[model samples]
Target: MQRAITAIYRTRDVAHLVRDELERLGLARHHITVIHKDVRTADPNAADTSGTVDPADGIVPAVGTAGGAYVGAGMVPGAYMGAMPGYGLGMPAYSEADLVYADAFDALHDLHLPEEDTRTYQQAIRNGDYVVSVEVDEDADIARIQEVMRRPEDVHDLTELDKTYRDAVYAPRRRPPREGYRDGMMGRRADLQNSPTTRDYIREEPLWPKGGTA
Candidate 1:
């Protein structure tokens, strides 16, 4: 049976280094995954060659504008200000942070961890930590994987880290230009609530050439 072993790092750099080390130890890149926030900024000088506005950027504002106009005209109810599109209901759209949380949750869920443990792991990611998980088919490789991942100085034991940050709160520093409506509609949107099954943000493909198992 394949089993997953995971570790948390305080920074993405260290987590990535550890992942490289794991690959060096003969684990297939596909057998390991990293879950973290998408912090990359788009280059301003980069031409919009695609000439496409991201839906996340475009749709939310349109919804808010239409909703506001209708509400002001007394045609639509005020309660539906931030309702998400395409659901045929007034569900709020998820923020980028929420999507990251969902991605982290889905990645952890693949391990079949207990619900509480999964939440704790997800919270770790939300707290600006990076998660590196490895799936090993051989029981003998578990110890080696753990050793490699935990060698970093800033690595933390999940439960202990949870206790340290349990009372702390996280607020995203940046928001998309038109996210005001979404934020006003729903702030923080239920804290790690969404459990999207798709691994939209995972890195599972083999990064190294095919090789024999460790």
Candidate 2:
């Protein structure tokens, strides 16, 4: 089985150049995946092309605008200040405004990356970074692939996302319902809250069935 290695870049143009370089270095184009945000349909003139942006910088103003608008709308009734159009700090990681526009490209190839790797790349792309993943079976090839794609300053290191990615990918698996557990309030109450990893809510008093006899 081939192992997947990924990298993130700042610009779509650079990502394309790296993809071409990877193809020339014996890595099959089909084995590479470039994951990025799609923004082709956006008005060409509407984009903010004023060089690089810090996600934190945009978040504050967007939040202030939303908060003020919400308050104004509540007071003035028909007057509505719509939500801020772009992403800024404090918003969820992958919200519409938080997305960074990527170069127009079709995902013709699939790297078949592991779930963990895919999650890692997904976060990077959502953070407005361009991501590239290449599969290689040989250990030596890993270094070569990275070397060709290396822009140390530009690469979004997967190591930094280890904690966040693992929590997102594995947390759901840890929370699967216990055997024979149902789905509604009945199940929630009956289910033994045993897992130490999650919150525990058990007591001698009956808190269900609308005031049941304890």
Candidate that scores best on TM-score: 1
Model 2 residue 170 CA deviation (Å) reads 9.6
- Model 2 alpha-carbon drift over 4 Å, by segment: 39-112, 137-140, 163-214
RMSD of model 2 against the true structure: 18.6
Error of 1 at 95 (Å): 8.3
Q: Number of clashes in every candidate structure?
A: 0, 4
Q: Tell me the tens digit of each residue's lDDT in model 2 across 1-214.
A: 2244556677777777777888788765544545565522121234433332222211111111111111110122222222233323333222233222221111201222334545555555555677665544433355566577776545544556646666542111111112222222121111342221111112231112222110
List TM-scores for all candidates, in order.
Answer: 0.49, 0.41
Pairs with steric clashes in candidate 2? 58-88, 59-88, 59-89, 87-97
lDDT of 1: 0.44
Q: What is the C-alpha RMSD of each candidate to the true structure, in Å?
A: 13.8, 18.6
